[model samples]
Each structure stands twice: as structure tokens, then as C-alpha cells.
Target: MSIRKRLSPEESRTAALEAARALLIETGPQSVTLKAVAGRIGRTHANLLHHFGSASGLQKALAKDLASSICAKIADAVIASRSGIGTPRDVVDLTFDAFDKEGAGALASWMLLSGNEDALDPIVDAIHDLVVELNEFGSEHLRDSTLALTLMALGDALLGGPLSASLELPRTAARDRAEAMLLGSIDQAGTLAPEG
Candidate 1:
């Protein structure tokens, strides 16, 4: 009888990572474990060690993946707007939506496991890059990018809060409020503009 060869180290880690992400999204991050991740990917505990030196290592990789994915989505949403019509509001909405239960669970894990602000540095840099890409503001609008990031973070925090447990009505209401506030700010700024 021919014996089936086991997956290589890289393949095992890749599978484990993918499975961890899926489980994190579907069930919750608490569902993740060496045994569970291995089983989900049809591998054994020994196989997981080949990829991640330890549970902490796996957690670090997962945190990195979550940060990358979240920042990418936020960046795309920011860059997609050309109308400038409530763009900040759109960003607020999209950012909060990105923090759905799955994302929230992952974020919770990041806070508990990593808990280091340095771990969030990459994500902050990514948002800064996103701002530079989406904005064409001169010296006068210098503060706009900063403002946008702050407000967007606030919105993300709110939506990630326990008060935002429901995904449907609460999210819609928050988006609507954000849209109104953003539009109001834009309109007020336009009124204060000096005539050409």
C-alpha cells in the first residue's frame, strides 16, 4: 500500500492561516487553537508546529493578516470616492462595517494578545498612505487628513463597541448620522469659502 505524504511546512502554515481566518470570521477567534486549526485544515498538531513555532507565533501572524486586510479595505474605500460628496461619511460607514462580528472578534484577540501600540503602527501608516492617496489638499487643508483619520477611528471604535452588537439597524443608523454630519460640515465649509 502506498502511504500518503504529509503536507510541507509552508503548505501546512498556509492552510492553518487560512483556516484560522475562516474560523475567526465564521465562528470567532476564540474558536481558534492549534488542534482546531489543524483539524479544520485536515492537518495534525505536529504539522502546525512546522509553520508556527508556537501559539504566540501563530497569533502574531494572524494579527498581521487581520491588520493588512482591514487597512486594505479601508484604503480602497477611501480611494473609491471621487465625488467628494460626503466622502468622509462614506469612509465612516465602510470602516465600521469592516468591524463586523468576525472583525470585532479578531480585533479583540489583537488587543488581548498583542496589546502593543507598535503592533498597530503598520495599520496607522497604512491609513496615512491611504489619506495621501485620496487627498489632494494643499497647505490649507492640511488638517483635513488628520481630521478624517480621527473621525474614522472614532466611528470604527463606536461600531466595534458592544453597543453596536447588531449589524443591521444600528449600523444603518450610525451611517445615516455620519452622512448627515459629514454633509453638514461640507456645506458649512462651502459657505465660508471666499468668493473667487
Candidate 2:
């Protein structure tokens, strides 16, 4: 029989995360499993356990990975947008794009359906970081507006069809409407709707 190769602890953990991320991107978060990720990377379920403790651990790790990457992209976009190199909306667009194109939407939907409270922690932290970064860049004025747009974008990424139906807009145009709504609110002086 042929022998399998071995990996260091760091390499194994990284491989597990990569496998989980690929499974998430390809088949959505519902399909991710420690066994599946371990199998995908030619490792064992025990290896996953050693690295991640359990499936919940793996899911939390995966969620953190996705959220961190999305936040990093947002951070990069902010850096790129300095000196009016990009519009303020670019950050919103990038955030939405990350949620849509980078599997954050699927992760969010999965976490919500699974009632995974731990998963949301990373996303909330990332958003907080983004808000701080925006404020630091002199866009403190955009805080409320930015948070609203981010909610819309993230909500749309998962529920665009329903939102479109509710608004009588095409599925593809929900984002455009969201952007317009944000722009309209940009000139308004207020806090976030005074949460009830």
C-alpha cells in the first residue's frame, strides 16, 4: 500500500481552513464538514479535531477566515480610496461584492439558519473595524449612512430576490436601488433610526 504524506501542525491547520473555504465557495456553507474538509485535504477527521476541536470549531474558524478576508479587502479598498482615488460608495460596493462573490453571503445565511452565534461575532468585529477605519479616514460623517448601506448590501446578497419582489425591482437592480437609497440619505443629518 502507498503511504500518505504528513503535515506540520501549522500546515495542517492551514490546509483544513483552505479545504473548508473551498467547500464553502463551491458548495455553500451547508456542505462544510470536518470530515469532508479533512478528506478533501487528504487528512483525517482526528486531524481536524486536533486543529479545530470539532465541527462547530471548524465552522467558527471558517467563518472567521471568510470575515477576516472580507474585512481585509475592505481595509485595502479604503487605503486605495485615499485622496479621492475612489468614491465613498466604493467601500459599500466592495463590501457587497465580498459578501456576494466571496461566499460571505452564503456563510451569513448558513450561520443564521444554523443559529450560529459564534459565527456572527467575527463579522460584527470586522464591521466594527471597518467603521473605525472609515472614521479614521475622515469619513466619520458617513458612519450611520455607511452602516445602513452595509446592512442593505449584506441583506441583499442573501435575500435580493425577495427584496426585489417587495420593491417591485428586478433581482439584478436591487443593489442599484440600495445605492440610490444610501445616496439620498447621505445628506440627511441623523443617527440610525433610533433602534426600538
Looking at candidate 2, the ten consecutive residues that score lowest on lDDT are 186-195
Please provide, for model 2 over 1-196, each residue's C-alpha lDDT reduced to its tens digit, 9 standing for 90 to 100. Answer: 9688788899888888998888988988887888899889988888789888878788888878877887787777666665657654676688777777777777877877787767778777878877786665344456666667678778877887787889898876856765666556544423433434
Query: What lDDT does model 1 reach?
Result: 0.59
How big is the RMSD of model 2?
5.1
| CA RMSD per model (angstroms) | 5.2, 5.1
List runs of model 1 lying over 4 Å from the truth: 1-10, 83-90, 104-106, 109-125, 132-171, 180-196
The C-alpha lDDT values of all candidates are 0.59, 0.75
lDDT of 1 by residue, 21-104 (tens): 787778776666778898787777777776777655666577666656766766665565444433666666556555553354
TM-score result, candidate 1 = 0.63
